[model samples]
Target chain A: MSEFKQAEHKLLLIPGPIEFSDPVLLANATPGTAHTSPAFIPVFGESIKLLRKVLLSTEESGSQPILIAGSGTLGWDAVGVNLVERGDEVVVLNTGYFGDSFAECLEIYGAKVNQVKAEVGNIPTDDAIIQALASKPKIITITHVDTSTGVLSPAQHISSLVKKHSPETLIVLDAVCSVASEEIKFDEWGLDVIISATQKGLGVPPGLSVVLASKRAVEASENRKTPQQGYYISWKKWIPIMKNYEAGKPSYFATPPVQLIYALHTALESITAKPISERIDAHKAASKYVKDELTALGLDFVPKSRDIAANGMTAVRFPSGLKAPDVLPKLAERDIVVAAGLHKAIVTEYFRIGHMGVTAVDRQRGDLEKVINGIKEVLGKK
Target chain B: MSEFKQAEHKLLLIPGPIEFSDPVLLANATPGTAHTSPAFIPVFGESIKLLRKVLLSTEESGSQPILIAGSGTLGWDAVGVNLVERGDEVVVLNTGYFGDSFAECLEIYGAKVNQVKAEVGNIPTDDAIIQALASKPKIITITHVDTSTGVLSPAQHISSLVKKHSPETLIVLDAVCSVASEEIKFDEWGLDVIISATQKGLGVPPGLSVVLASKRAVEASENRKTPQQGYYISWKKWIPIMKNYEAGKPSYFATPPVQLIYALHTALESITAKPISERIDAHKAASKYVKDELTALGLDFVPKSRDIAANGMTAVRFPSGLKAPDVLPKLAERDIVVAAGLHKAIVTEYFRIGHMGVTAVDRQRGDLEKVINGIKEVLGKK
Candidate 1:
């Protein structure tokens, strides 16, 4: 119906919805298709299966239902709104900004939050978490990677602790930033609910959020999350539609974003084409290269230890006297965009460079080097 | 990262995501620019301005608040989640499917629903409505077009009636199928909230639902609707972001579908290129032609009067004992796809043809003729 135009910009090295390639971007401009079309159901059906496969789960053993929506963070509302009875006791693990945000969101929903916090860039110990669960947290919510502190909580380790101590507490891991960057292992990690997004490690544009739900999550949803259900986050209707649609009676609660799904379908194919090991390794390599360059620049790190830093992002403390406001605008003048820390505590102190969705080894290195040099120049260390 | 793939079908002409021209589809695929990029914010800003313009609202009197998410139906959720409080009275005029859906959805949000009934294909008179709203209602919800019945209600008339009878009640119109197909004056009609989506009149893909908010809608939203708010549907965070994103600070409640917006921006240009009046007239003329052809083929109009029929779609009733299912697959084999009647009473009695989007003019006319001739050929009608 119209001509699509491209904006003139150099690149986005920001965490999530990072610089997707031109061809990938063009995927969204495809002609809209009817969501219930015979051709669409299979493609959509296969996508949920592939998403499970990528998350290292299966329909039977994993039993985590998958739903595609417009935002990744919606997964939090889905989990918190469902499985959360009014005044349900939910233990929130305050690892960093996202964890706090999740707790605040749950509090809004009338959940009593018992926080088990760790130092901003450190992981909480299994014992510390077990002690917190003494209050009987109905839901144990944790972030896989906190965007602000660049901390990757050992979700697998925490899930193990919750299983042993609070056997009944449902576990929800916010994998919004980590799913594509590293191994989520939904089944292997015994994750009850895993929330992810297309933009982050998946390398697709922002819009679609993926939820991997266990049978427990669904069952819990039925008993705990009922009445006055928020329309935007209902997995109940979507589940039946997805089930019926694949079996041949396709329908929707609302109009499916056909073109974005086209792009996401393409993005999914790319992820599923290669083995998960290869994809994770590529992100690992990309992260290593960016970290090395920054280390060589003599900058301080935000995380207390390198092991705690997120694979998807490397957060480095800005030069002692320099703030992100000053450094970021200078970076922007050159058309290179990086992420400002989300937490008010470190928003002025640190900046993040994301390395997800890289097309080639060389391109990742090139973008990292450009960022490295820009940082150096800004700090007068070049 | 890998070769991109298009949707499986060779033809995607059902309805919604009608047919994105090549360049428009590709626009969404562009790399993730900083949402607050000097280059990007203006583009985002322009989209809001363009929407306000097309929806026929004054810029000063209106605020271009953008909320990015899935489907037009979410607009209803946004309005309810943000505006309709528990025990508040919401009047829903049910001319067709979405009107019923609006009533049902509002009821879910704890609103006391006053569902004003109308004949399946007839608009409820403004007088009937004003009498119905003798007691002040919190909101007046109506639909411009009923996609299920091919009926266009007198939406403007209802808005004026609400203004006269209950000035305090907000006027919320579901213009999902009528915004671009027909005229939807968001401001002039005193409509507080007008919801349309990408697929139908907008001439884009089916992923995003765009809603326009008048000053009153925003004012009403300031009142808390629910004890708990769904984050995805929360306008508190979204409205402020929309008002400020142009200043290079991008704060969105949910991760917006980036590519979808890009394609929409492109499609919007095409829709507004020709004056909207011409587009509206063309659809009206085309719909009349289809109706005439069906009448010539000895079929009755689904809606009693031509004036009641929607310009975007034409629903034609089949002869007695003629099932739509029997003729649909046969027509599909001949390369035309039409919608089956949604109401159970009309399921076997009627079928509908969509004439919106980039449907070739003669092909559309010929398609109607083919459907009519094909039905005649199949039923052994002389």
Candidate 2:
């Protein structure tokens, strides 16, 4: 759109650091702009407002968004350090590798973690979640879409169950892989917190950790009984900074990534220009096409059922005799890049393809088609 | 160099997020590149090696560099959680605001911090440091250049005193404001750790936290008595990831910031193209010119003397009957930007001007000349 063209490169069909738009990249190429400059203040403020719209949150909903310079994993630290005090009980609905890691992160901060782990290709059952809630854990974490196995947990249903069974327990959704591609109704779903990053569905580079906390979640962090165990990840230092920026004033706790923030501002402008539902619908349509094509190719999926599959990406088990080396290298030779399996349980049996952001919403790119055809050619099923 | 031109904006003369080169910005504009991709592995590996050269470290010196997606503040978390166990005795050589914040960060992780305080715009006395070393603290932290007051401590002299008085104490330097613009001999100066960020003298955007640790410092982190109090900031998870990238292998604990790494790679390539001392010398020359011009205008400096002042930036106190409101806005009117004071003790008495990276090294840009001329015009001294 800006008359700038990126150099030719392999199609990055992996989960994240997804293909960004030219305008977004151009914004990222911004010259030195002070974080507190008059020109950058509105950019930061507008980004905060746009994030609320993307999450289906509102001013009256009393939800606050925090943008920090870190990866999605740092979101785990933000939650672990800010909301959970030492010896507090936390329930983790484990779907795949991310669930185990999230639980591990919480445990590192001295949480007494209770995990409801599903099988390799499945989501935890409702019965297991309800059982875990009986203990009345202080917080319950759900990986909305785990990147490892492409397992999509039902966020709304889980939040409903938590509201009915343990209304006081804070609901934190790890939406790293699901945010823009999947339909999320934050306030309607009674969600308290959603942790995400820029590289996935946000259509920006990987440098920002975006988290939204409900009013109650903020109050909980403010009411912590002990001194914060970590400094950089503490909410106390960041809340004022966010409040100031959103108020169109310049403030600094730690330096914000100015260029990355510019990229995010441009990406968000494009994303929110149309109705967000339309974008989500486009992702849904793309997901179905890719899944249907893969199924027709006689491939099996990591998610046990189509309903539990992530719309942003898909994990397909290789044919019995084929492995990653047998298929991945061949695809690479064709200038297509996909990821090997990440779940430790089935690391060698499957591979993954991501269809999010421009890859999913911008059909003109034909990225999904390229991935499907590449897979077919590699498997000798063309 | 890449034929990419950034839009013109106000000259950023703040402490950091200084002016970046076009090539570095173009690199930041890179399209999607997977963190584990072979194409990205070498970029990351070379950035690590280049960081060593900038810091005067080497593989033979057993110094390892850790690059993470966070601000310079995150570096404190990495050191605090990894090296200081519960109730560990630590001494902070306080120069200004940064020293206080560093001590607070360490205390959050259960360190007992003893700060050797100095007056505003002054470094701690040798007697005070020697007396603090009598306690034989586990670590002694120094602020090489405190951005708040533009006070530069004598890093080599402090490390020498620590080595002579408390040989077991780990010497840490907070070089966030002085990594490339100032000389730091990591091995020869007996420094165990040097904490920095990308935006300062590295000429990249402010997203990546770069910290270099000597072998003994790495060992100290490895031998922590207590479990890590933080998860994302843990060295245990990051050491292997850094090592793998440096070894040209792909590994992941959390996703690295792919585009920022590309920018850092380009910036480091340029920074290490010549002897690092040349870059330091350029910063020195620029600093002297700015200081002399300000002095000719009858301005007082925040630093007590030129010998202890930082080469990357200068803090100048307002003459009687003048303040930031009287000068900063006028500079802004001329499209020249400088920062108001950050040190609380002199918040209304002074302002800061940065001369680092491209702004200091690329004289052809005439950035310094413009800043000097703008200041003279604003003060009606032209």
Candidate 3:
């Protein structure tokens, strides 16, 4: 129990399951405690309260937060199975691979999905969205930061557009990669839902699928005539449990991932103790530092414009004649790890580096420094 | 960093989130590593292979193990959404609370469910099962050990009966409470699916939903005409990923719970290092010891007979004029943690104690001794 120091290992710079803070990892090493214990109830409740703050939503905003035991992809299932009824028309604003997957998930739930797919590393334009909205879609899905291309969709602009053009349309933002690292105004933007995970910008290991539902979304779920097609991910069962926990009462639907929730509690505490603006600014600063160095190395990015690039990660094209194996191993030898491309069309053409959470906010670890130097050394750049 | 040693705390004697071994807890404290890393691939691959051994499955038996990031309930969702198609007739044998939940999950997926109920601590008898099977249900669901009542259903006998009478009926066993603590011959018993979680008998912190699918279940998933209503829990997306990982190739459909999987890897290694029979025997001996001590104090059990009781845990009725608060607090003062009642009809009538994993098997920790002593002190029954 020697103060819970993380063991020395190669720096993890992947998009998720990223390098975690000492306190966060240590929190996960807690002794086996019952989910229903008095000590754990408050931990879970406070975590729920902290989630509202993370999204800049107050009690008056009438938003509910969910903490379920699943990966971020399960968030898509929650949105699909709960929100989209059979044959409901949904507009999916596709930025990259994650967008494609989300569209497919909605279709699985019997939704008639209209995917407005963007070219690699780009998001759909507002005009295109306005056109899609003309069809009077029931819901519009946006990937805040698609991990595959490190492309950040204009969520704020899209949310505003949806509110003005189609006041009844529900706006769902997939913020799995952007929650703590980028700016999101749940109440101000009138977002119906924000789906995220404990990993990535939350500075915790991956497991819990964290979701926030606005008043409108919950109302829609309540008024839907059709029964929910799924059970574990259904909003109906989770709503009561979430409400009980937030009101300082312990309730159970399914056993929550006890240790992961504890870790999320510690991570959220670290993220919320400081102004969220500072965290987002820190991520931008770290992202700029890495991007600037990579640009100087004559590397090109997948994203066409810097404005569209995500603050938490950078996807850069590999040099001509060099595939992932050529450069990844060199970085691995230098005790650093990065991600290969995920966009199916250009998967071998690019690689991604993540600078979120502690790796971005707590620079004392010099993780970014090592990553910069490792890449420079690997690419024969001074 | 030093090796992980969990800080001393009260002994966790609940049914799940059991006391983990030092090695298992240490494995969870590992520094964050990418799920697709070369080092992680083999670890995950080996974990899959080890699951087969734990279930006593052979490679040629065509049983596939799925490791998903979720609670035990997700395992039920996996079975429901994938195996039980719309309007499919399914028979659910109700042993306790978990059976009710599983039946509800199947109904959520549009299955026509027939639940054969038993008394508080007993499982549905062979005659009742034979009557239910006469309807020629597509799947027969059995809870190996219903955690709420510590009732062990006769999985082997039920499996044999299903194979004998309804040869095509898929036998799905909810083994969340029994997997590592009891004997399950996955191949020999001809089970189609065995759903479990890491927190229970696997002796790891809760999160991963570990499922084993037989060839028939896989075929059922594949040959179904109606599209899968779920995406995250769908076998179609996960089957390729599981196959790829088992083949030692890292593939991603969703980000796996990296830390919990590592913990499971360590826990499984410890469980499989010794003969599985010894582990089951240890659980039985521990259960007898605790039950004997309680019986000497004139306490009754929810389970009507020792043969029907689960080896991993015991559900004992409270003495006259005593309730959970009266006895549990005193036990907590002695640093022993147990569980309150869960069966709805007799919600306040009993409490449960878990004697699985290292608490029951290792014995060196003297955890069971503390639990027995704590209870005796609480009841003034030395």
Worst 10 residues of 2 chain B by lDDT: B1-10
Model 1 has a DockQ score of 0.52
All candidates: TM-score: 0.92, 0.99, 0.99
**DockQ of predictions, in order shown:** 0.52, 0.87, 0.87
Q: Taking chain A by itself, what TM-score does each prediction score?
A: 0.92, 0.99, 0.98
Candidate 3 lDDT over A184-244, as tens digits, reads 9899999999999988999888899999999999999888878888889988999999988
Which regions of candidate 2 are displaced past 4 Å? none
> What lDDT score is found at residue A157 in candidate 2?
93
Model 3: how far is B142 from its true place, Å?
A: 0.6
Q: Which model, 1 or 2, shows the larger lDDT?
A: 2
Full-model lDDT, candidate 1: 0.73
Sequence-dependent TM-score of model 1: 0.92
Pick by lDDT: 2 or 3, better one: 2
Top of the candidates by lDDT? 2
Which regions of candidate 3 deviate over 4 angstroms? none
Itemize residue pairs with steric clashes in candidate 3: none
What CAPRI grade goes to candidate 3?
A: high
